[model samples]
Target: MGNSEATLRVDNVTKRFGDFTAVEGLSFDVRAGRVFGFLGPNGAGKTTTIRMIVGITAPDEGKIELFGERMSPKMQDRIGYLPEERGLYKKMKIVDQLRYFAALKDVPQSVADKRIDKWLERMNLAEWKNKKTTDLSKGMQQKIQFISTVLHDPDLLILDEPFSGLDPVNVEFMIDVMSEFKSQDKTIIFSTHLMETAERLCNDILLINKSKKVISGSLREVKASYGKNLIALRAVGGEAMLGDRSLVAKATEHSDEIEIELAENADPQALLKKLIESGANISKFEKVEPSLNDIFIDQIGGVK
Candidate 1:
C-alpha cells in the first residue's frame, strides 16, 4: 500500500436501525494500491460497514472520505462493488449486461465495448461472452458477476465474500485475479470470514468483533503479538514420541504428529532433544508460526 496516493477514510462511523445498532464507532483507512481485509465472524458488522462505504446505506453518524473528497453520488462511478449477495439478471447475455452496467456508470459505447472485450479475455470468459448469465453454472455465474464489478476500471473495489462457494480451483483463479488488480495500483477492500485467504492476500487487515475493531495491523505484527511460538513435530513412534505432555505447554494432535504451542520459557531445543532420545524416530520437528484462525479465536472468541 502506497502512502502517497489518497486513502479511503471512515471516521468514527456508526449506523443504526430503530432499536439495533449495526455498526458503532467503526473506523479505518483503505490505503491506495493494496488489498485490505475486512474480517469478522458472521454478523460482526462487516456488511454494514461496507454498505456505508459504497453509499448504499448512510452512516447515522460520522463521515466517509474517498480520494480526499466526501463520498457523494458522483463517486459511484469511481468504485466497483461486489456485494455478498448475487444480483445480476439471469436473462441478460454477458456482453449486453456488461455494456448496460458500463453505460450506467457513464461509460461511452466504443470504450465500453473495447474494455468489455479486454476483461472478458483477461478473465477467460471470452467464449462465454455471448451466453446468457442464466446458462452458466453457479461458479461461472460468480465469475461473470465479478467481471461486471470491475468492467468500468474503477480505482477502488469493495468485494464481500468473493470466494464463498468457489471450489479450490476457482478460488485459486480468484486469488490470481485479485493479484492482478493489486499490480495496477487499484485499492481493494475484501470482506470475508475465510481466514486463510485473508492471511495470504491482504497487505493489511482489520478484525472486528461486536461492531468494534479488535485488531488491525500488518500480518506479521499481529501474529507476533500473540506471544506463543507454534511447533509441529512428526515422528515414527507412537504417542510415547510426545513424551510426558507436561514437558510441552499445549499440544494438538494431527493425524501423524502433534502440534504444540510452546510456552515462552520452554526451550524448543530441549524439547527436540527429548523427543529424539525417546526413540521417536523424528522425521521433522519445526517451529511454526500462528495462523490467522488462532489469532481470531484468541481475539473474537467462539461463535454465538
Candidate 2:
C-alpha cells in the first residue's frame, strides 16, 4: 500500500468448482516494482488465487486487471509464472527446455540463445546446460526452472512457493536474484509458508487463512498494529520482578535469562527503574515487537 500505482488488481474475486469454493471474495492489489508476499497454510487457496490472476482459471465473480486493462493474451505474455508443482521434462536437455519455453513466450530463437547462454553462465549452470534435466540435481533443476521463468524477461512474475526445495545458501542466492529483478522494475508476487524469507524479502504482505484475508500491509504497519510492547531482561535477581504480575503479562524463561511481555499501560521507564532497584543485572532490555511469524500464527491459527 505504500505506492498507489496498481500493476495487478483482484477485485472481490471468487472461484468455484462444482460445489467447492476455492477462493471467496479475495481482493488485493500488487503495486508495480514491489515484492508482494502471499502467505497461507496448506490448501488455503493460494495456488488457486494465483491461477485466477494468471488467467489459467477465470473467477466466477469479480474481475482482474493487469496494467490498467482486463486480463488478456497480451498481458499473459508479459507474465512469468513458476507453479508450485515443478514441471520440467526430466529427460529434456536444459538448454532445449529453456529454448522451448522462450519460444512459447514469443522470444526469437536467436535472442533466446544469447539470453540462455548468459543466464546459464551467471547462474553457474553453464556446464549443465547440455545435460539432461534428469542427470542434474534437484537444486540444479531448480536453477534451470528459474532461468526459464525469467528467460523472456516478463514484466510481472508470479512465483508459487519459489523457495520450496533449496538449501540455505541457494535460498539466499534466490533472494539476491529476486532483489536484482526488483531493481530492474519488475513486479514480483510470491507465496510462501516461510515467514523468515518473507520478513527479509518482501516489502509488503497479505496473510490469508481459510481463503480469507486476515492481515495486509507494510511490515512495520502490521507489527505496529499488533500493539505489543515487550522487553527481555537477563539477571540473577530479576526473578523477583517476574513475581510482580502488574508489570508483565507473561514471562518465558531460558537457561540463563527470561523474556517478558509488558502490559500496555505499564510505563517502560518505571519497569526499568524497578528492575534496577531489585538489584537485577540488566543484560538485555530491548522492545520485543511482534514478528511476521508471530502475526501469521495468531491470525491464521485463529481461523475457525
Candidate 3:
C-alpha cells in the first residue's frame, strides 16, 4: 500500500478492430506503489489495452493519462513495458542486447553498464554475459527481458504476463523483484489470468471478459463482496451428496479436495450433517471466502 495518488489512469477507454470491439469502456487506475492486476483470459483484449496504454496504438475512444498528463514521447522513459511476446536479437551477446535496450530508454552508457551487470549477476546470468541469447534457455531469456525492462529504473512498470513461461522458482524471483520495486515507491500493473498469482501479489484488480470490465476494486473489497459462502471440504464418500442443488450452488474440484459454494438460504450445518450421516470420513471442512477464480467463474460463466 502507498499513496492515494494515481500513477496511471485509463478513463473510458475503448478499442476496436474494424467491427470487432476489442475493449469497451474500460476504466481503471493504478495507485502509486501498488500492484494492479489486469486479469482476463486469452482474447480478452488485455494485450490490446496494454498496447494502448504504452502508446503502441491509440484508443478509439476515451483517453489515458500518466502522472497527470497524456502519454507523450517525453513520458515514455518514465515507464517500463515488458510485453507478453519475446523480442530479442538471437545473435547479439547478452550484454550488448541489454545495453542496446537500455539506450533506447535514453539511459547513459555508464549507468547502463552498471545496471546490466548488476541484473545479470542478480539473476545468475553473469557467467553467460558473452553468449548470444540463442544459447540460453527460454527461462533465462525471459529473465533477460525482465532485466532489460527495468534497466532504466522507471517509476512505473507494465508487465504483461511477465511470468508466463517461467518455472515456479523463476516466477518467485520475478515476484521478489516486483516487490522490491513496490518497496521503492514504484507502481506496477501486472497483467495475467492466473488468479492465484494475482491473489498473492495484487492490492487491486480488474477482471475483464470478452473485452468488458466485469469487476474492479481492492482485492479485499472484491472478495468481501462475494462473501464467505464457500467451504473447502475434504471428505470420502461425500461426492454424491454434493450434487444436491438445494444445498450446494457449485463445486469445483481442486487436488484432493472440493470447494463448495452454498446455495442461497442453504444451511452450512445441514450440508455437514448430511456428509456425517453418509458415513463419510471427513478430514477437513472450513468456511472460506470465494477465491478470485470462483468469482471469475461466476462472472465469466466458466473458465476460459
Which candidate wins on lDDT?
3
Q: What's the true lDDT of residue 290 in model 1?
A: 75
In terms of lDDT, the poorest run of 10 residues in model 3 is 295-304
**Residue-wise C-alpha lDDT for candidate 2, range 144-223, written one tens digit per residue:** 89889999998899988888778888888888889988888788998888898888888889988777777888778888
RMSD of each: 3.8, 2.7, 4.8
**Candidate 2 global lDDT:** 0.86
Q: Which ten residues in a row have the lowest lDDT in candidate 2?
A: 227-236
Q: Write the per-residue lDDT of candidate 3 for residues 260-293, one digit (tens) a residue.
A: 9999989999999999998889999998987898
- Model 3 CA RMSD to the hidden true structure, in angstroms: 4.8
Pitting candidate 1 against candidate 3, the one with the higher lDDT is 3
Q: For all candidates, what are the clash counts?
A: 1, 0, 0
Pairs of residues clashing in candidate 3:
none
Q: Write the per-residue lDDT of candidate 1 for residues 27-95, one digit (tens) a residue.
A: 888888889999998888898998888888889999999988999888989899999997678898888
Cα error of candidate 3 at position 293, Å? 1.2
Off by over 4 Å in 3: 231-285, 302-304
Q: What is each predicted model's overall lDDT from 0 to 1?
A: 0.84, 0.86, 0.91
Candidate 2: segments with Cα more than 4 A from true spot: 236-259, 265-270, 273-280
